[model samples]
Target: MLDFTKSSAPAFQNLTPAQFAEGRQQPGAVLLDVRRPDEFAAGHLPGAFNLDVTASDFGPRVAALDKTRPTYVYCRSGARSASAAGQLATAGFAQVANLLGGVLDWPGALTTK
Candidate 1:
């Protein structure tokens, strides 16, 4: 029952495709694609960093990021990224945003792999 949504400045927010696109434009945004490497190789948002949420190294990789930064995460259709977003929130990321519909509902063209 850590209600991140109740905070005045919520630590975690599930965003619509539009909100996600706009928010990631802010300076210092960290975009994380929490999908398999092959899935990422197929296509992803520009500047996305690939890191498998299911991979054994997921925890370590996530730890390498600056916890105080604004972190946005996505997967093919949201499920995986939602989990990752929760993890990010629990791990003390200052701002953790999950793309609601993932890449399937992305507002812009994915970078060709």
Candidate 2:
């Protein structure tokens, strides 16, 4: 259950690639990639789930996630993920993290599937 009547909204953190990697290893953490299917198929972080930000079901898909759990989001250039993070916060998500500069600034190894 989420308390949407709070006076203050939860602020999503802008984490660097290293910070984002470390945080994603935490228990109950969800790695969400907000890029298109084709972009995701090319390459993406290991274990990340695709939820295209441009899709019609984006809001509904995000709403289905556990709002209390920590969610890590990323996009091609960080723009879409940033927007997604804001949406999540507005939807009463308690914890949200955005990957600064998105995958473009990621210094970690990526996987293609």
TM-score, each model?
0.88, 0.89
- Model 2 clash tally, residue pairs: 0
| Candidate RMSDs in order | 3.6, 5.1
* Per-residue lDDT over 16-105 for candidate 1, one digit per residue giving the tens place of the 0 to 100 score: 999998999999999999999999999999999999999999998898899988999999999999999988887778999999989999
Question: Which pairs clash inside model 2?
Answer: none
**C-alpha lDDT of residue 79 in model 1:** 98
Runs in model 1 lying further than 4 Å from the true structure:
1-11
Badly placed stretches (over 4 Å) of model 2 are 1-10
lDDT of 2 by residue, 52-91 (tens): 9899999998889999999999999899999999889999
Among all candidates shown, the one with the greatest TM-score: 2
